[model samples]
Target: MEVVVGVDLGGTKISAALVDESGNIVADVRCHTQVEKGREFVIEQLTKTVGELFERAEGLGKRVLAIGIGSPGIIDPDSGVVVKAAVNLPQWEGISLKRIFEERFNVVAFADNDVNVMALGESLFGVAKGLKNVIFIAIGTGIGGGIVVDGKLYHGSTFTAGEIGHMTILPEGPKCACGNYGCLEALASGPSIARRAKEYIAKGVATSLSELVDDEITCEHVAKAASKGDALCRRLLEEAGRYIGVAVASLMNVLNPDCVVIGGGVAQAGEILLTPIRHEVALRAISPAPVLQSLLRENAGEIGAAALAFSKLAEKD
Candidate 1:
């Protein structure tokens, strides 16, 4: 059997899996990123994990075909280098992941933005499977998106097409990390939601959310509070949902996708967030779509990486 290695490189862990063409995992390994140890350390960890998978695949009599990776930061798709990285991946800039892995494993390799791989995974196997046009929004520390158009991932002219989080949601509102005012990430991302909760506490809002956390407030705390029926937490998440909905509604009209999939840690809040988002989408969209949570959840990245390799290999063929 011929299999490809699909790797998901994250701030905390690097997961590598040997996946068959049908999106089935033949072998897998996970290792800590140890990001604080710097860029080379993280790369070493990735090599170790992928090496383990290679051994496992060999044991199972599977021939390794290629490697595909999904990682954070601005990637040069052609070179597979991280052009810029987010804060989570310190000093990861300019690392050529594809070059390193391909040389190490002696196989062709592919890499791209994590969310872009995620969109491909969704289209090929996950919730959005069987759909021709799909959009994937990941709401976590920040909101990122991937757009699949007409059964293919659209990389735009410069290979940076899926930046749904940067869309301006509130024209004179909060300043975003990208130095823009009121981008969707600023308004509805996990940190932004947590910040809103902190703002409420500063104003002495009567919410039990503050009592639920052990440290500085986090989106998880708010989500937990909302799950427990804390009115303030519910309202906070719902408000974020509404903002997300507004942006999604705009996407629905402009892209005309069959569905929009939401994933990431913050999306784990379930209906408290989705309810408001769905309502707002219903109210605002010229064309509405099913707003659904990711079925793949934590596995999306690894599986998505495999899907990326499959797509790229197909293009070569």
Candidate 2:
């Protein structure tokens, strides 16, 4: 059996998996990113994890072909270099991930933004399977997205095509981390949801959400509270959903994709969040596509990275 290694490197953790060509996860391993330990340290962890997957694949009589990485920030796919990353990655500027991994493992390597990889996974094997056009949105600490068109992942000329979160939504809305105002991320991301809750609590509005967490509240707390019918939390999440819906509707009109897939931790809010988004899209889009949750969930990135490796390997044939 032929297999490839896919590594999903995030701000907090690193997950590596051995995946077959058909998208089955043969074996997997994970470890802390320990970002404070610095870039080389994180690279070591990634290498060690891939080594473990390699051993496991060999034990199972699978031949390893290549390696692929799904990581944060803008990646130059041709160079396998991370041109820039968020603050969470801490000094991850201009790191040549592809060359390092290729030299370390003595195999061909491929890399792209993490969310783009997730879209690739979903398009090829998950909810968007057999579809030629798809959009994937990951709502977490921040919102990131990926676009797949004509059955292939679309990387714009600058390789920044899928930055759905940064789209200016309100024009005069809240300041975003990217120095933009009224970005979809600034209004609807996980941290944005928490911030909305905090703003409401500071206004002395009565709510059960404040009693749930001692420190700065999280989106999860708000989601749970909304699930229990906390009016304030419910309203906040619904408002966020509306903002997300507006953005998605714009995407639908522009791209006309087969579907939109929502994923990431914050998406766990499920129907409480999706219902409002659907309503807003219905109101806004000319002809809205179906908005679906990611079927692969957390494994999408790793699986997509493996798919990338497999695709590259096939090109050589």
Candidate 3:
């Protein structure tokens, strides 16, 4: 059997897996991304992990055909270089990931933004399968999106085309990590949701969330509280959903994809989060054209990354 290796480089961990053409995992491995140790260490970790995965695939009688990597930050897919990354990993900027990996592994290697890889994965195997045009939006510690057009992942000129997170919904609202004000991520991401909830609690809003967790209140906590009828938490989710809806609405007006898949940590909020998003999309989005809708939530990143590798292997044929 032929297999391809997929690596997902995140702020905290590096997960590499050998995936078959059918989107099945033949082998998998993981390692911590010690950010404080700097870029060399992270790259070394990725190298070693990929090598090990290759060996494991060999042991399983699967020939490694290619490799694909999904990483955070702005990537130039044509050049296989990372332009900028905010995950605080050392020396990640301007790294030629594809060249280095291909030379080291003696196989073709492709790299792109993690979210794009996820979207590709979904298009091939998951919820977005059979859809030619789709969007994959992940709401996590940060927000990111991927665009697939005509069955191909669309990496706009700079490979930064699908940065939906940076879309300014409120021009003068809260400060975002990109040094912008009122970007979608600042108002609707996991951290944003948690911060909003905490702000409400600080201002003496009565919420069961206050007593749920002692210290670091998270969006997960808020979702749980809302599930149990905590009015404040529900309201907070609704507010976040509204902001996200506005962003999605804008995307609908622009891309008009067949499906929008929502994933990542915060998506665990499930229907409580999606219901408001759908309602708000209907209300605020440009009318006449139906707004896009989410297909699947959760595991999108992993599955998408794996699918990307599998696709790369298939391309060789």
Q: What is the number of backbone collisions in each predicted candidate, taken in the order shown? A: 0, 0, 0
TM-score for each prediction?
0.94, 0.96, 0.92
lDDT of each: 0.89, 0.89, 0.80
Residue-level lDDT of model 3, residues 204-242, one tens digit each, is 989887775545898888888889999998998889888
lDDT of 1 by residue, 163-233 (tens): 99999999999999989999999999999999999888889899987575535889998999899999989
* Residue 88 local lDDT, model 2: 82
TM-score of 3: 0.92
lDDT of 1: 0.89
- Candidate 1's error at 76, in angstroms? 2.0
Candidate 2 accuracy as lDDT: 0.89
Q: Which 10 successive residues of model 2 have the least lDDT summed?
A: 209-218
Provide the RMSD of all predictions against the true structure, rounded to 1 decimal.
1.7, 1.5, 2.3
Model 1 TM-score, 2 decimals: 0.94
